[model samples]
Target chain A: MSASVALSVEGLAFSYGGKKALDDVNFKIRSGECTLLLGPNGAGKSTLFSLITRLYDTRDGRIELCGFDVKQQTRKALANLGIVFQQTTLDMDLTVLQNLRYHAALHGMGGKFANQRIQEELERLRLYERRNEKVRQLNGGHKRRVEIARALLHKPSLLLLDEPTVGLDMPSRQAIVEYVHQLASSKQLAVLWASHLIDEVYPDDHVIVLHKGQVKANGTVDEVLKATHTGQIKDAFYSLTQGEHA
Target chain B: MNIIHFWRALWGIVGRELWRFVTQRERFISALVRPLVWLFVFAAGFRAALGLAIMPPYETYILYEVYITPGLCGMIQLFNGMQSSLSMVYDREMGSMRILLVCPLPRWFLLLSKLLAGTGVSVLQVYVFLGIAWFYDIQAPWQGYLWLLPALVLSGLMLGALGLLLSSFIKQLENFAGVMNFVIFPMFFMSTALYPLWKLKESSALLHNLAQYNPFSQAVELLRFALYAQFNQSAFIYVFVAFIAFMAVAVIGYNPSKGMMIKKAGV
Candidate 1:
């Protein structure tokens, strides 16, 4: 594996009893790039994320992070990964700083260094002023920002976001999209963002169209558009999945 | 993982639990109130009804409240264990558990840390209950208080592990009430918590045998002896072994490959 390749999955497959959730799925995400994993509901998006995070063990295939095998060397592999789950995972009663500190401690970060990193991430997200406030006091968008800050505190090479903006307002969604895109380019962080919203895809972003537990298309935005014989991502996505859902 | 990482993760889990416990005043109050009510009202009402013989731990005849103190301590731990597991189920459903599971540590260690954290919380609750019991003039020997610490830790861990094991089986918040009705009540009532083994034997041989084998009985017996600065080897061994067995299965239940996560993944 190349040093820049932060995440690699090959021949990944998972099943719940007799029903297959992810079927021989394969993908790689490199640092300094954002990969949009576009799929509708029940398209195995969550299954793939579960596999990557080792929430469910991978049996049929292999997943590696930063050159470490996820199954064999799970500790090292996961050390290079930061994740913002689909649901808001913050402790609502705890202050924003306490929540981030808890996360940092979980990753083996502590003392002065952990506090410094926390300050930097919160400042970068423009949430430094609200650090003392309880997460329950923050709005939805601000909570998401705190989660993002917490995810980055450990400075993982790869970041996975599972439909993070599903319930946010338009402005909040746009802000997160812009922030993540900028973060990926500036920090050389590899990001695999799962979303069904076609409008969230940028022209420069790499796109992977997953449908029915299979990757229908994987390429640049322009490449997918050209390959599907469409002008817009909406058309490309519809053509790729045969208009299953937007 | 290195020892420092393991230690930090454990601290984080325990610290978060303590922070939550401090913030939820109602949780702490309710945890105390249940045992306190039993100590204050039930024990008082039953004091006249139930006459006591000289139990092994007690050199002289004891009041009903004094007899049930250790049992009530076990009750505090029992309820705290279930309460912690209830939070685990809620965390799993609310998605916060995912954050903890995804940490760069062994799943067993993470679960163990969680068990330890719950044990810590329950121990705190037990002490507070003991303190209040002291105010009610049900004081143990001064050194017995010291001995009770390790006893409480062991009992807390065993009961918390049982709760952790139960949490893995519980899929939704809705199923928790069923557990309270089924597991908690039966374990508390059938054991030596409220009555002695001889009393249970007089009532029914079946209940006597059940209470004899009940791990909660062993826990309470262990605490009962420790409260007098005495040690019951059998109860100690029983609780220790129970802790190990429950912890092993609880770890297995949380295993993603071989356990409940498989069924949960489908959800």
Candidate 2:
């Protein structure tokens, strides 16, 4: 509810036919911080990302980006948002630069402005030399970097990455995690990073642990550990998600 | 967004589509080859069997190739429309369509941009087919080519919108082949793309009525009339209305509604 809050979701609900995917989910992501949406598979993490990104309708409750309601003021709300989906979205046939330029155009950037922004993003990601290469030629790690750069090309205040490191080596995953952490502070961006990997959670970062379509825990990593009476994030996540089943 | 920006975005999408079209050389060749085979192979076999009266657009006997040329143009648009839809299914599966949909622009505008881009490619293919046909002695007035431009675009939009509407209903790439078998082939075989309504009526009144109601037939008739420097008011109205209806349905299907199967994202 603070002025600096970049994204806010309250009582969000969604269902697929007879099955509920999300129920009464609530959280807020503030600027200059990275919040991990830590959940196992089928925990409604992707569904929540879908709702926040306006990929699905906010049927029951509200999601706002930079104070703009995603449903009503959709254009304005989406203008402040950037997203890197779980699947690789870059056009493999196009060069790395072409992929970024295409994304910029989708956000209404053109000509000199689009070019300069693409150049800046490429350099920032250290993929400038590979800009002319087809995206398929780039390795898994570089492809993710290009995607992150594409998402940032529009200068969105809020970034939503849905299980972005799902298919990568440990080193690549660690590098991406560290890179986005740097981006959060350096760019003053509010990032909602969804992942099932327990290792991705850092003690200082905010975490929202979802289980079976419900918000099981929402607090900093240390607070989550404290509330669950656990010594580590992995154990904390386990107790919160699997305690009833166990 | 400003008009310039809108145009730029449209250009970007269209440019990517064009780039893909060029890279996929077989797509361009197949797009042309389907209609050419109909024009040369199929039409040639039927040339001796089917005779033509002096229609209003023709002052003399016309070759079967010339008669079906416009229909073949319509065929190109039809196939291209479905081709684009197939790609839409693939894009959805591959997650690129999600990127296009999440843009801050109006959904209608984005879909229209996609329609226009696909139509642009279809138009290019149509002209290439026409250019090759001209060499085969299928002649029209020089002005006919000029008139064909707008006609191709209008008909292309109608077919493309239909493709978009179909894509919205198709849940996966595998389901799209069913669309081709049920939707594409039926629409093509039942339409005036291959024969005139009178010919269909001579065969069966019910078949004639069905062909008359088929929007693909209306689109072909519009192209036929336009290519000969004539206007068919009914055909134009049919296609225009079909465009609106198809586009509306497509937009509705793509909307994140509560009960729609399309509401499921990222899968």
Candidate 3:
């Protein structure tokens, strides 16, 4: 399949008071592809998310989103990306629909068009009925779904999520994963889903295993598991990244 | 490209905050209580103890209660500054900061919107204080109402920007307590709020000079003049400089890449 890269990074590095958070990290997500960036805690996964989202700046490297430099064309680069951070951003006092409207306005979408898009997005997230409910009244799963809905309102080409399901019940987690895969397939949205869980990365999905801020494995699940010579993907991950703990 | 989103997001955040402010009736009322305590209790107590000769904004012998209204408004902005920053710390720990930081617009604007919203809340509180001041027979020139609006806005911006700047530096909430003791209170009392500069000069020329130089003192003086339906070009310039300096620092503090968010130590 002929495809263009939706996200591209080269020689990215960041530090804080001389502590390395991300080091020489590099990767790319092709258009319409759902790629999982798997890493353990402190493996620089969040840091990479920060840099790609322009939360961090680095003169040592470059990041281009849909062929635009993140540092230079910040607003333009951000317009092409939709991000659902692990931390919930929804205003608890606001109705679900108001949250979407605010985001639409933030993206300069207003009036009739913004209202139409808001309805369309809420329905897509299966949140049409709960549009008027304050977010504090929603369940954890529903809140997460609302965030996913908010992320989609602008129809961003590149969707990024950083450990979005860290603390949730099995049902909620499973539902999120199910919805995400469904959305990716239906919308052909290029996704860079970062997580530590191996099961989240499917057999066919492109997987990049990051260890200590560097790529230890990249390819399909079968390839990463085969490289570590482990039957279970979890065991393969631990074997490749966890030295003495193994 | 779309200010609608930016303004809408700002409205959403401000609306949420405003609702929070109103819902917590005790908090909303309490915000007024601290400044009023100083106005009625402290100012009344000191009325007989201290006497003002005359001041620029004051045409004749003025009551101490009237003299302190602008200072009280300044105090409201100052206290609200810390409150806003403290809320930012709480939001950061609560994970809500992430939601705001990821907004499509520039991070600086997002934080500015937040600051402006906070200033709105602060100004609302100041008006309430002014209402109470009116009941106590303390009032500004009736026409002064028009000029006071921009003065409030400029001072509010300076204080809001100061709050955002502080929010960007402090890593923890507990650390802010020390700031109140050393920075906030001193910044309040050391200014020409409670007393005139000439009065301070009679006591000590150095302290008077320092009080005159305090950016906050300039803000209060500008308000004093505006409330008298007059202008203070030098004082306006001084407040303008402080506002710009504070805003520049705030913009840098919230630069996203090199800001207080990255310095976060887990919590």
Which ten residues in a row are the worst by lDDT in model 2 chain A?
A: A237-246
Runs in model 3 lying further than 4 Å from the true structure: A1-3, A243-246, B2-20, B256-267
What would the per-residue lDDT of candidate 3 be over residues B67-114, giving only the tens digit for each residue? 888898898988888899888977876767766766667776887778
Of the pair 1 and 3, which is ahead by TM-score? 1
Q: Report the C-alpha lDDT of model 1 over B136-221, residue by residue, as the tens digit.
A: 99999999999999999999999999999999989899999999999999999999999999999998999999999999999999
What candidate 1 gets wrong by more than 4 Å, as runs, is none
**Which pairs, if any, clash in model 3?**
A105-B4, A105-B5, A106-B5, A106-B6, A108-B2
Question: Model 1: per-residue lDDT, tens digit, A19-46?
Answer: 8778888888899999999987888998
Q: At residue B38, give the lDDT of candidate 1.
A: 97
Candidate 3 structure quality by residue, lDDT tens digits, A41-94: 778887788778776675568998888888888878888898888888877877
Candidate 1, position A125, lDDT? 91
DockQ of each: 0.76, 0.60, 0.42
lDDT of 1 at B69: 94
Q: Between candidates 2 and 3, which one is better according to TM-score?
A: 2
Q: Between the candidate structures 2 and 3, which one is better when assessed by DockQ?
A: 2
Model 2: how far is B246 from its true place, Å?
0.6
